[model samples]
Target: MSRLAVAGARHVVTVDPDDTVLHDTTVVVEDGTIVEVRPASAGPVDADEVLDGTGRLLLPGLVNVHTHLPMTLLRGLAEDVDLQGFLTRVWAAEAAVMDPPTVQLGATLGALESLLGGCTTQLDMYFHHDAAHRGALAAGSRHVTGPVFLDGPGPDGLTWQAREELLRAWPAQLAALGGPQVPVAALPHATYTCSPERLAQVAATLREVAGDRPALLSTHVSENAAENADVAARYGRTPTEVLADAGWLTGDLPVVVGHGVHLSDSDRGRLAAAGASVAHCPGSNQKLASGALHWEAVRESGVRLGIGTDGCSSSNDLDMWQAIRQAALLARLTSGRPDAASAHEVLRAATLGGAEALGLGDVVGSVEVGKRADLVLVDLEQPHLTPVHDVHALLVFAAGRADVTDVVVDGEVVVRGSRSTRVDTPALLARARDRAAAAGAAAEAS
Candidate 1:
């Protein structure tokens, strides 16, 4: 069995059930699972490879519950626009530039960026999903992606019948594609794009294909006031109610709603009762002028909450550290209480909450024995990170992505010394630049 260890961490933020913090710790991994979290004084550990973690703060790899990985090529293309206008411009660009090969390229670039920033898992929703999956896997990300359903022919040009066939073939295709951490997920675009009947059909298809394994059902919901109004006019109910009526919020299948910026009190109650989770994308919401998701209200309503960076097109980057800090600060501003969303609560929302929302809680959320060893080491020797009085507070209020020095997914070090071990970064950046230029020209022509 392959063995690796991260030894002598200054502080291990376990993020366990009790939020345990260990000093001078060594974490041992064998065959991709955490075997031991030992003390530094507990004697030397036997391992084939060991990474020195001294002067670092060890954490569970960050999780992003909602993102369109292939949209990295469209970053800054749709800025200063509302959700409706953003979609109009971005969709046109996608039509011009987002073929399967380009999708893979963009997904690879996005995944590389995310992984280098210490985000190990991404619940990505995008077109050409097989290509996106391969691209993210190439960057060593625990990518959660599957078939996407749309009301009409989308950029990929699949007919409704073809989409159904693709959904039916998803399980076998996912198995063959082979991401050990990937789950079976059904991503319908959104209520406005998919009718209620189509939503029910998609749900049934997901149920049939997923069998007894718990599947994830994710879609956009109430991302802005206009979106909510449109959904209400179309279906005579809020987006949440439309989903509930379609049988999506039934708790039988795990549900993750992306950018729930306009969810109502009643909607929050239903989601909490149904055991669904909301992915709060504060950066995108703020940039697009979408109303804030009442962070305190959502949590007080008993709903599980997680944080996300929607897509680079709207949010401008995939930086979970920024997202975490924004989430905490935005909560305070919206809730009118300084202590509303505490540092510990927002940190958990970024880590364990996101993992659970993706239905990978049992696999990779915390630094616990028997879990897959997806970990990150943040260099705390910097001036900005100096004098760490409260670890969680420091992480939430002060830390940034540049502090991430190493990242490991499934016990393999994909990033060391802030550089990727999987791909050539300079080459990837050049390709992304070329692709982005093409995308820009496409949008201009359109």
Candidate 2:
């Protein structure tokens, strides 16, 4: 087994059960699990690889609970529009350019972007998730993705029959992708896009195949007032109620919704009771002028809430740092309470809260002995980070993506010295640029 040691971190923000913060700490890793966390007085750690963490803050790798990986190619495609307009314009662009190879390439670019931003794991929903896995392998990031289920002809132009085949074969395909095993999502697009019968069929199939580890079903829910009105008219229920009636909210299979922005009080209670979670993409919601998610209400409802960047197509970036900050700001602003979301709370939302939401809390969320060593180091030598009065405040408010100097996933270094250790950065950028231009040309032609 390989060994790695992170020595002399200025501050180790262990988002542990106790929310502990250790100073001048050393973390030792064996194989891919954390083996020891030591104080400065505990003596040096001996290992095959030593990462000097001095003058830097060490943090558990951030988790992005929701994303559409290949939509990196579609970033800025339909910006400054309402959610509906974004879908209409962006979907057309995606249809024109997102062939198999392009999808894989875009996923690669997105995976790299996520890694650079200090996110180690992501829950992604998109078509051609087989290709998304290929990109994850290249970037060495943990990814949970699966086939998307939508009624009518979907974005990929796959028939309903073809989409079902993709969903049915997802298990074997996901298993074949080598690396640490991750959950598969039975991702339907939304309440409006899927019929009650199709939702029931998906639930039954996934429940049987998944057994003890039920497949986490992800779908967009209660994104905006308009969507809520439509669902209320058609199903005579809130989106949450529509899902609940179809048996999506009950049972062992985890329900991970993309947005719970407009969920009513009863809706939140129902989801909380069913142990479902929400990927709260505050940044995306605010950017699109969608209503703020009632964060305090959701927290009070006992629902598991995690931060998400949604997708680059809508949010235009996969910066978890920005998402974390936005969650804090939005909660305070919308709730009319300055103390509504503390720095520590938002940090937890970005880290352990996100992990638990995805059902991976046991493995990758925090820096604990016997847990997977998904970690990040942020450089503290900068002017902005100097003389930190409060570590959590500085980290949550002042830190940016460029401050991330190194990242490790599963005890292996994937990023070092602010650059990807394994990815060909220039090549990836060139390919993305070339493909994006080609897509733009194709869009104009069509």
Candidate 3:
């Protein structure tokens, strides 16, 4: 068992329901779980490793509830293209050229970027998700992966048969990890891409794999305007209504709907009633020209909200700090109310809210004793973050990715001094660059 201690932090934002902040505190971790969080008066306990959190703001590690990890290979490839043009020109081209090794390499690089930026956990959806799982493990970060299921064949021949095989193999693969194992979730892609029959099949597959245990279900919903219109045209119902009709909202299964930007009032009510959660990707939505999400309405409807970067391909970065800042700004802009989303609320959405969305709230998310010791230390000595009057405000508004000095996940120091401890950054970047060059060549040839 590994023992670690983090001491002398100016403030530790727990993000717990009580909104507690311990000043000049110390946190002790044993065997990947937090054992104690007390004031400096508790004294220094024995530990194999000691993290100096002096002049730093210690907070729970950020959780990204929705992302496409391997798409890091396609970052900035469609910068000037609209959503449709991007899907047709950039995404289609890259998907055709992405192979297993490239996918794994890209995912590994993406994980490294996330870790350096203070993200410890990410819920990822993409083809060849097994490689993504391996990449996350190799990077020493926690991730939940699911094979994307669509009506037609996706990259890597993600047909219905392949989807079933992936689902069947996921549990044992996760179990082999020894600890919590990277849990598997079911991703149906979207209502526009999957048929009603395929949606029902996805639900059945989730039930089969879960079998008296809780499971996660995620899908893109109301992400694009055309998707909403198409659903209504085909089924005479909204996307949420169509999903409900297909029984995708049933059971005790946890569902995370990504990009609920254009959800109607009834849809919001249904999501609240079904206890479903939403992943608000403000950066991606704004980048793709998708309308702003109704953050105020969603919160008032009692729906849990999590922040996501979506993917490097769309948002062009995996930095959760940027995502957090963007989410706060966008929420305020959309609501037209200066007090709509406070810094504290945005930070909570990035941490505990994301954990709840992914069904891991009981184990991780906050700095409570007995919870997993997944935390980040932000350097408060930076010029931009100087003279911090409000810790939460500085965290959400002023802090950038470079402010993340150290990150610990599962009692392990995965990132120290804003660098990855598990991965070779130079080698990973070289491999990723090589893969991207090869993919670009292939795209041109095709």
Candidate 4:
């Protein structure tokens, strides 16, 4: 039995049922599952691998529920634009250079960056999904991705029949592209890009693929006023109404709405009644000047809320720490209250909340015995993290990606000493720069 132990932690912030915090804890893992979380004073643990956690804070690895991993090549391609303008520019650029091999290259770079920054799971949405999945797996991440549906020939030039074939083969494809535990996920681009009929068909296909397993449906929803208006113009209904009409809201699968920034009062009620979750991407929303998600209203609506740093093209980075901080601060600004969203609340959204949003809550959300060991160690010995008053506050407000010292996914150390162990960092960055330059040239030529 493979065994690993992380001992002598200053604190183990378990985002568990009661938000338990243990000081000087040692967590033991066997064959990818956590077996014990004891105290440092309980003596040493025998294991094949040991990670010293002195002066470090252990946390459940951050989950990014909404991302386009392959878009790392277009990091700065669509700056200073709203959602509509941003999509137009990005789509044009994507068509210019987003082949499967390039997608794999960009995805590897993005996954390596995410792992080094302490995020271990990503629910990614993009075409050429098989390539994206392979790329993330190469970086040793729990990448949850599957077939994507689009009404017309999108970036990958897939037709309607090809899309269906891809959906039908998704389960086997996912099994072939092996990695850590990952849930089946289906992504429809958005209400504006896909018609209501196409959305229903996509839902049906996902049902066919999932069979007896739990699955999730994620899509862009109500990201901005203009998007809602566009959906209304096309379908005579709001994006929420369109999705509800297609049975996605009330379907057997749980829904994860990306950037519900313009959700109306009635819309929030619909999502809450259907038990759907919303991925609150505060950084992307603020960057694009999309309206803010009402923190108090959504909380009152009883909709599960998770935080995400949207695609690197939109948010410019997959830093869950920044997403956590932006979410907490935005909640205060949007609710006009000092205590609108607490540090613990936002941190939970990044960890357990995000896991729940992706329908992997029971698998990788918290630090519990029998759960998969996806964890992060934040070095509290930094000058900026000195004299920690509240652990949650320090993590949400003060800690940056630079403070992450080690990361483990599925009982294996993928990152140590703030570098990815599974990736060649220097080579990945070089390829990313070269690909981005080529994409720029291709776009200009087009």
| Steric overlap count per candidate | 0, 0, 0, 0
The most accurate candidate by lDDT is 1
Please give the lDDT score at residue 377 for candidate 2: 97
Error of 1 at 14 (Å): 0.7
Model 2: per-residue Cα lDDT at residue 344: 91
TM of each candidate vs. truth: 0.99, 0.97, 0.97, 0.98
TM-score of 4: 0.98
> What Cα-based lDDT does every candidate model obtain?
0.92, 0.87, 0.85, 0.90
Q: Write the per-residue lDDT of candidate 2 for residues 372-416, one digit (tens) a residue.
A: 999999999999998988999998899989999999998989999
Q: Tell me the spans in candidate 2 whose CA falls farther than 4 Å from its real position.
A: 442-446
lDDT of 3 at 109: 83
Q: Model 2 misses residue 81 by how many Å?
A: 1.4
Per-residue lDDT, model 2, residue 22, is 92
Clashing pairs in 1: none
Candidate 3 has its poorest 10 consecutive residues by lDDT at 175-184
Candidate 4 per-residue C-alpha lDDT over 1-446 given as tens digits, one digit per residue, 9 for 90 to 100: 99999999999999999999999999999999999999899999999999999999999999998989899898888888999888878888888889999999988988988998999999899898899999999999999888788888998899988988887888888887778978778888999888899898888888988898778888999999999988888888889999999989884677999999989889999999988989999999999999899887898898889988899889999988898898999899988998998888888989999898888899998999989999999999899999988999999889999999999999999998988888888888888898899777765554
lDDT, candidate 1, 268-355, per-residue tens: 9999998999999999999999989889999999889999999999999999999999999999999899999998899999999999
Best first by TM-score, ranked? 1, 4, 2, 3
RMSD of each: 0.9, 1.3, 1.5, 1.0
